[model samples]
Every structure is written in structure tokens, then in C-alpha cells.
Target: MTDANTTAFTNPSTFILLGIPGLEVAHVWISIPFCTMYVIAILGNFAILFIVKREPSLHGPMYYFLCMLAITDLVLSTSTLPKILAIFWFNSREIDFSACLTQMFFIHCFSEIESGIFAAMAFDRYVAICHPLRHSTILTNSLVMKIGLVILLRGSILILPCPLLARQWPYCRTNIIPHTQCENMYVVRLACADTRISSYYGLFVLYCRIGLDVSFIILSYIQILRAIFSLPTKDARLKTFGTCGSHICVILAFYIPTLFASLTSRFGHNLPRYFQVFISNVYLLVPPMLNPVIYGVRTKEIRNRLLRLFTHKGTKAFSSGVGPQTDLPGVAGW
Candidate 1:
């Protein structure tokens, strides 16, 4: 009996994704919202990129950071949504081992990249609000490009080891992943061999990237708030806060669920399987769908441009001086 049981388990070429485990019956129904969110994420992020690129007025550091964010959101959501939809719609649960690793890498790497972008955006807001006169000079085009490269490299370099380590493990137990997508720990936990190295390395990467990013973001915001309160009039403070509204919303949208999901995955071993899966999916899907909406609604510049685009008005050609400079001392054409 022991020999037969041992013989039944072997290294699998493909891993099976179980969509939602105990909630299998609701896969189709649950997919409707997931599919809707994915579509919105794609269209909304692309539209943001298009609007920012075409509207010369938005060629500032804030918008440039926003464009990076939109691009990251696009890659992050695209990495997993299609497979999730396939599992729900067509029952195509089998994912090649290589493909699963690739998906895991993109999902995690881009998530860290997205977090880094958020940190960059926070710095942009800090400079725009705290040192408005030096905003452009400090965040020059060259500096922005460098920041992007650093963010990309940080995420890729730190997360590269996760998949490489997972690849080295011997998965002789089972190939069935209970969640929808190939999360790092989920994949590593299936290994029949010692997983301590991979597990510790994952924690290290998480602290090195996300923990530091969050800390910096909080510091930036605190400094920004202090700067805002130093203004003499209530109206000035209010305007500055209004300018920061979109960014604060976007930051919360991305980090809250991400931190919750990560903590739950690490410590909530007693939680129901379906609940865990649902939260993980929400962490991936919610931010991308909401970011564009939050920015479009809260940012007057983007909103007006979007309205003009849909109204068939002729958009002025791209030019550095075309955008009208604002009168607010601490707000740089926000």
C-alpha cells in the first residue's frame, strides 16, 4: 500500500489550479465580476496612458509617475486574469510548470514594482507640494527615467530568486494549487522537500522591498502634511489637500489589500480556504480597476482633458509651454 501510494505521486509537468476550492460551484458566477474588473483594468489603464501621452499639459513629473503606475497596473493584472477567467469559463485548470512560474514572477515582481511606483508618486507629490518652485528642476526628465529603471531593477532582482528557488524544489506530493493563480508561497509549499530557504527568502524580499517602500511613503506624506499646514490661509491648505487627494486614494487602494493579503497568507492558516482565495483575488483585481477611476474623478486636469477628448474638441499639439501654469504656490499645475 505504501509503495503504491508513493508510486502515485511524481513530479508533475503541469500544475492544476482549483479556481476557488470549496466554492467550485460558484466559479462561473464569481467570474463575471472578475472578468468585468479585468476589462476595466485594461481599458482604464490604456486610456490613462493615452491621455497622459497626448495631453501635453500632463507631461509633468506627477503625470509621468502616473503613467508608470498605469503601465505597472496593466502588466500586473494581465499576468493572472486571463488564466483565472479560463478556469472559470472553460474549466481549463491545467497550467504548464514553466507558465506557472512565469505567472508567479510577473504577479509578484510587478506588484513590488507597483509599490515602488507608488513610493515614487508620493515623492513627486511631496516635491510638488513642499517645494513647488523646484518641482521641475528636481524631478527632471532624466531623473524620472532613472527612478523608473531603479524601480524595475529592484522588483525584478529581488523577485527573481523566488521562482528560481521554487524550480529547485522537488514536488513529489501533489501538483494541485488550491488558489486561482500561482502565488509564490502556494507553489513552494507543495514541495515535498525542505521549504525553509524559499520561505525565509520570500520574507526577506518582502521586507526589503515593500516594507521599506511603505515606510518611505509614510514619511513623505507626513512631511507633505506639515508643509500644507504651514500655509497661512485655510483655502491654501484645502487646495493643497485637494491636489493630493487622488494620490492618497491610489496609495490606499494598492497597499491596504496587498498588506492584508500578504499577512493572511503568512499567518491566517486557520482561515477558511475560500475566504483566503477570495481575498487574494481581490488584492490583485481591486486596485487596477479603481486607480483610473480615482484619478479621473479627483484630478481636475485629467478630468477636463478626458471630457474634451470625448466631446470631439480639437486637442492642442504637444508643447512644453502650452499648459497654463497655476497660481497656487505649493501646487504645481495640479
Candidate 2:
């Protein structure tokens, strides 16, 4: 056999992203459903961004964090969805090495952006709950912008090295990425160069940057709960914690699946493929869907604003048909 022919057959250029083994045609079957989710996630988060932007009253730290969250959701879903659909619907599973690296860069960058924003949200919540009087001074717009700058700086710095590590590999034949998108670990695994450095860096950044970020969030909440309980009135205490409950729920949703994915990849990559995709989807889509809901429920003002958007003009007609109704401005806003 010719050398070129041997190399061609043995050295894979790309792998079909056969999702979830044992679920026959896992690639084709998951395409329609997952694509639907991608659309919903993008639209839902965009709606939140639109509502926040148009509503003058939502110009606060919580809303600011919500905006950041919406953007991150778009970033992550964009990173994963197109490649997945290509694999499933069109039988177009091949991705150029450079495209894979590019996807990997954005995926890690945006995931860290979400993490960093959650930490910032926790700090914002701490100030708002623990020191209500200083909430304005503590979470000023300038300060919030600075926090955004930090997220940009930190997320870029953390994820830049992984792609650089990807490029160091000689690509000596193995190009099949096991998953749909170019996840960091899979890219590193395909590298022909020694991947010890890449593996160490990936884990190190995971533990130090994300681990430290989660620590700060938990610490902020601990202090916030203490302050909430020390308040003299039950109503005051409830009101204080209520302000941050949405944020708390969001943080939990974002962190748990990400942490689980990290741990599973480290130890259980051989586990069921369905499990991996399930975790990935939950982590990516749940936050985008829940962020709006959490804010609507906890803030009250956002909920009422949304209600007003739909029903305020129709109120007269509704009263004539179903009886009379009145919405106090304050209650309506909340």
C-alpha cells in the first residue's frame, strides 16, 4: 500500500458526533429537539435583554447582572448549537481544525464570563441586602461597568492559553472529536504534542479561577443571610433576602452542572453519552430560561412591568367583561 493511502485510512480528519451510544442514530434523533431548545434559549434570553433595556425602571444592579447573564447565555448557546445541528440534521459532521479551536475558545470564555458575572452578582446582592442604605453607593453604574471590565479581562486571560495549547499539537492523524462541539478537553486530547501541560492548566484554571469564584459567592451569601436574620422585623428580613433570592437560584443553577461536568470529564468520560449531553444542555439552557423567571418572581417590579406590557391597555375592556379591576402603581410595579 502507498504511504499516502495508509495515512488517509488510518489518520482520521473528523469524527461523526454520534451522541449518546445505545440510543441508535443519537445524532439524528437529538438534532430536532436540541435545535428547538437552542432557539428557545436564544429567544428567551433576548427577550429578557429587551425588556430590561426598554424599561427605565430596571436600571439597577440586579437588572445589570441579568443583562450580563442574558448575553452569556447567547454566547454559550451560539458556541454549541450550530455545530450540533450541522451534525444531526445535514450529516455535516466535519469541522476544520481551526474552526474547532475557535469554537473551543469562545465556549470556555463565555462559560467563565457567566461564572464571573455570578460572582459579581453575589457581591451586588451582599451590598444590597446587608447594607440597604449604601446600595446605591456600592453598586453605582461606574462600579458595575468596572466589574464588567474585570469579567472581560479575567475570562479572556483564563481561556486564551487553552487554544494556544491546542495549536501546539502537530495533528499527527487523530482528529476525531468525540462530542458535538470542540470542548477544551477533547481538543487537548487530539493534540499530537505532549498534553500534560494542557491538562494541568485546564484543571488548575478550573480549580483556582472558578473554584475561587464560587468560594466568594458562597461567602457573600453567608454574610447576606446573617445580615438578613439580624434585622429587627420579620418583614424587614424577608424583604431583604427577597431581593437576592433570584440571584441565589441563578447562581446555583449555573454552578452545579458546570462543576459536575468538570468532575465527570475528569473521571467518567466513558459513562453514558446521554448523560453527558443531558448535563451540557441543562447547564446551558436552564440559566437562560430561569433568569427571567427568577427576577420576575423575586423582584415583583419586573413581573408587574411585564404584566402591564400585556394587560395595562386592555384593562378597560377586561373590566367591562369580567368585572372591575384596579392596579395600584406601587403594587403594579412590584
Candidate 1 achieves a global lDDT of 0.85
lDDT by residue for model 2 (1-334), tens: 1332235333244434544435537667676678777777776677778878976666776677778878888888887787777767776767766777788898888888888998888887777666666777778888998999899889999999998887776666555556667788866776566889989999987885568999998899899889879888898777666566677787888888888877777778687766775676667656666666666666565665567667776556433444222221111111
**Model 2 off-target regions past 4 Å?**
1-16, 21-24, 312-334
Error of 1 at 201 (Å): 1.3
Name the candidate that leads on TM-score. 1
RMSD of each: 2.8, 5.2
Q: Looking at model 2, which ten-residue stretch has the lowest summed lDDT?
A: 325-334
Q: In candidate 2, which residue pairs clash?
A: 300-334, 301-333, 301-334
Q: What TM-score against the true fold does each predicted structure earn?
A: 0.94, 0.85
Q: On residues 1-334, what C-alpha lDDT tens digit does candidate 1 reach at each position?
A: 2332354465678888989989999999999999999999998889899998986667777788889989988998999999999999999988999999999999999999988998988898888888888877999988999999999999999999999999988888678899999999899989889899998998887886568998999999999999989999999888778887887887888888887888888899999988989999998999999998888777767777788778866455323234434555436433
> What lDDT, from 0 to 1, does candidate 2 have?
0.72
Which one is best on lDDT? 1
lDDT of each: 0.85, 0.72
